[model samples]
Target: MEYVEHRMNDEAVKAAASAGLVSPLNILLLSIILYTGYSTFFAKTSYPQLPKPPPPVVFKTYNPHTLLPFNGENGAPIFFAVRGVVFDVTPGRNFYGPGGPYANFAGRDATRGLACGSFDESMLTKDLDGPLDTLADLGPDEMDALRGWEERFTEKYNIIGKFVSMKDFEELGKKE
Candidate 1:
């Protein structure tokens, strides 16, 4: 009986000693380490990953009849009517030189080349010559047709210049 009581007392003493040895300072140190680690990682500021969209495209256009050497009947002109306006396009070429580089007439944007042009800009520039070709006898309708096409074109492209038509061409010769 006494031996059993002594063994139990010894076990109780060992348990008490182990429980008492739980140092508050050690517990505080462990808590601080855990808090610092959590704050440094999970509690800190974070940013989300997102995708970026591509830049917008710009369009370009040219007026017909401002250019030279316009086509006649290798094919007739292709006339376009839109928004109460009329336009005629005759296929041909005009010599570009000096300040007007071939690439610029092609709408290459000089610095950026073909890549700089929009889908419409690039498409329109295909086989297009210069202000001379663009202006060459595209067609003549009522002045209102010119106005509508001009308005539609201006919506897409910047109108850099105007055409000196065949009438002006004859007038120039008469003047000089």
Candidate 2:
């Protein structure tokens, strides 16, 4: 009788396995394990995307008087002009600031001064009017020096705008 009962119990367990039957607790546990494994290995974490930068500001023409405010004094930015191009030299504030070595050149075009190697106040104006024809007297060496300064400015600073010429002003008048 004992042997028969033991054989019947083994048969019952085998029948349950062959029929694909399992307890509700076992099914729930297996589902939880599968979900945890998938989340750890296959799930990706989400992150916030960064915004795009704004466009750059551009100035078509810059007048000498308009360029005066950025002289590295009284909380203004330092700017200088070489040739016909305007450059922002705020990075060299110690040299271009007020009372500095090149302070007189802060608000003006210093093309002639740079060419002649003179920091004279008379050589620092942006006026291209009559009786002020200084650049015309410059020799080859002076012109080369001016070119070198222009190249240095182009390499070092940002070219904000170009100097507005008398011809350009006249053309603007014509357009209107």
The root-mean-square deviation over C-alpha atoms between each candidate and the true structure, in angstroms, is 14.8, 6.3
Q: Give me the candidate number with maximum TM-score.
A: 2
Prediction-by-prediction clash tally: 13, 0
Whole-model Cα lDDT per candidate? 0.39, 0.79
TM-score of 2: 0.61
Cα lDDT of model 1 by residue, 1-176, tens digit: 99999999999999988876687977888899999999998995768968786344322122333332222223323232222122232121121221222312331221112122222334233432332223233434433454554565546443333333345445666888
What is the per-residue lDDT of model 2 for residues 1-176, given as tens digits with 9 covering 90 to 100?
99999999999989989666577877899999999999989999778988886446476565666667778888798887777788988888888889889998996787888999999987866464312234788899999998998998889888888766555655666898
User: TM-score per candidate, in order?
Assistant: 0.21, 0.61
Best by lDDT: 2
- Model 2's number of clashes is 0
Q: State the displacement of the C-alpha of residue 116, model 1, in Å, after optimal TM-score superposition.
A: 49
